[model samples]
Target: MRLPDKTTKMEQAVAAIPDGAAVMLGGFGVPGTPFLLIQELVRQGKRDLTVIKNDANETGMGVDHLLVAGCVSRLITTHLGLNANAIKQMNDATIAVEFCAQGILAERIRAGGAGLRGILTDIGMDTELGAGKPRVTLDGQAWMVETALRADVALLHAAAADTFGNLRYAATARNFNPLMAMAADTVIVEAEQIVAPGALAPDDIHTPGPFVDHVVHIPELTQEYAVVRR
Candidate 1:
């Protein structure tokens, strides 16, 4: 069957994401996230969601809405420095947080998509990150073993996407979206522009059609102050 288009709306794209489902959100900070779709989920009161992303939304954008709405139960991310509300929630034990280095997190998702069981990395050793996590010995060297991460659904943002689901992202905005697309059972992409098939050069496609299940078009809405330039 063909995939849905960006104009299909967030509700239609996310209808299958249950209350307690696990989700992976695409973005490094706020610039690359599907903010409209996240807002819609908040409006729908979808709670107990386990979200995996790079960081919480900045002060006024991205996943911050979900955090404020209490829609998220757990968060696995590289940083939460920009989100004071999320930090407070984590401190208060309102939400469970799993910290991982950015590179490792992306690799985990890629590994998951590739059907790998887990990965051995020394990035977390001798630190809080490796405290209680599983470890494995590879060639007589102990490495922190992180399991592959997959999600029931993945929410991604793209600069452009075709009706056939091929996606293209702007420079730095290509953060975790591509990996999330591969790791999730259902991939929903929010794009600013929707083009016809083959409009994007094959070499430029960040995420291919087979990995995308749905597309939601959100032409720049109100400008929010949540994103900060690096």
Candidate 2:
């Protein structure tokens, strides 16, 4: 059976997000970040949010705008080195930051999507990253139990999407989008191009329509380089 078209306006796409919400932002830098939706979120003045992402984006772009708007209270990400503003906020206790290993972060989200409690790994064992986490021993080997990561809403950007919400990503833009889509209760996508269902080949679909709740079509395509100019 075909799914209903989930296309919506930017405001409606972010309306479901409440203050203090845990939001998974799909992007490896700006490639897959939903900038338009993020802009609307900033305009809405929602605060005290917990944002989950691969990295804190560079200043004045993408996720950095959230930091600038002071909307994010906590950040769960691989690193903040790319975003000087985030680093300053973390240091000043303006925002709390949790640094997870990149691979572990990905696996945790994947575990959440797969309905697993968590996965045990030795990646951060005996290190600051695993300092307080519980560890279990199996076959004389110890591993830290990393809980699965889930979110209330996931913000995503797609290269193209069908009316039914099936998504296609461009190049590295596919990085965290598909995983977050599955792990979040609400998945909202900002699509560069919107087409009819079946326009995208089955094999080309990166995220299925069933996992997506809403899609916002962007009339103009905007690209931002991931590089940080210091």
Candidate 3:
């Protein structure tokens, strides 16, 4: 079958995600987050979600929205320092949090996208993060094996996207979006601007259309983060 046109409404996009599904969210903080899609998910009251992200965003924003909605059952991420809610929830045993070293987290997702079993690293070896996990020695060097990370759905934010679903992300916002797009079963991108195919140059495209399953056009944000166009 031919590839389908991926443009979709935000509501319909988030509605397709079921409870208890593993979800990968692309963003370092608020910069590249799919805020509208995340809002819709919270509004829809999705439950038992396993969220995989780089960090738990600040309280009352981003990933914190999901946490506040009590929708997330588990979080696999590198940091949660800025989000006090995540820390409290973890302390309360309300949410399960798995901490991975930053570099290891990225490598794990990259490995998943490349169809590798996992990535081996010595970064956290002998530390709490590596405790109880399997280990292997390569060339006489001890390395902790971090399993590849994959998700049922990935939510991403792009600065611009073509109708065909090709995406481009702004600086800083580009962090995890590209890798997560490749690692998920389905990827839904929220774009500030959507253009016709070929509007985006090949060199400018960060994510090719084939990896994306859906796209929703949002407005652009100014330097101050105010919505400049709606």
Candidate 4:
């Protein structure tokens, strides 16, 4: 189906997501996240979601919205220092947290996109992370093998997207969006601007349309945060 336009609401954009699905979220430090759509998901009371992200919610904002709504069941992230609510929930045994190194997290998603079984890295070796997971030897050396990470759905943010779904991000705002797009079964993008097809220059396209399944414009939500300038 063709992607939705800017006039479409967040509920409409996220309607295809079923309850209890795994979702990979794009953004880091509240910069490029699709907050409006995520808020809508919480409002809809979708439950038991497994989320993969760079970090837990920021201290005062971001993914904590989901945590507060009790929509998330599990989180796989690099750090959890920011969102106090999430920490409290975890400590209370209300949420399950799985920690991974930042680089390893990115590589796992990349491996998912490339159809590889997993990625081998030393970042988690000789620690609690390496003890339980399977290890494999490559070139006579042991590596902490992380499985490829594919989510049932992926939530992404972009600076601009064409009607056909070619996407572009502004500067550092790119973050984990593009990689998550490729690694998910259903890739939904929230954009600040949605133009007619071909409006984005070929050189500026960070993600091609085939990887995107849905697109919706939600510019108002991003105005509160710093966006990458064109």
Candidate that scores best on lDDT: 2
Best by TM-score: 2
Q: List the residue pairs that clash in candidate 3.
A: none
In model 2, what is the error at residue 94, expressed in angstroms? 0.4
TM-score of every model? Answer: 0.93, 0.95, 0.93, 0.91
Write one digit per residue (lDDT tens) for candidate 1, span 1-230: 55555346678778778999999998876667877778888888899999999999776687898998889999999999988999999999999999998899999999999899788899968989888888888899898888899999999889899987899988888989889999999889988889987688889898898898887877776465244556
Sorted on TM-score, highest at the top, how do the candidates line up?
A: 2, 3, 1, 4
**Which candidate do you rate higher for lDDT, 1 or 2?**
2
TM-score of 1: 0.93
Give a tens-digit lDDT track for model 4, residues 84-194: 898998899899999888988999998998889898788768988787888778899988778999999999889899977799987777889999989999888888888
RMSD (Å) of each candidate, 1 decimal: 2.3, 1.7, 3.2, 3.4
In lDDT terms, how accurate is model 1? Answer: 0.86
Relative to the true structure, candidate 4 has a C-alpha RMSD (angstroms) of 3.4
**Regions of model 1 farther than 4 Å from truth:** 1-7, 225-230
**Candidate 2 weakest ten by summed lDDT:** 221-230
RMSD of 2: 1.7
Q: How do the residues 18-112 of candidate 3 rate in per-residue lDDT, one tens digit apiece? A: 99999999988777887777888899999999999999978767799899999999999999999899999999999999998887888898899
Worst 10 residues of 1 by lDDT: 221-230
Off by over 4 Å in 4: 1-9, 222-230
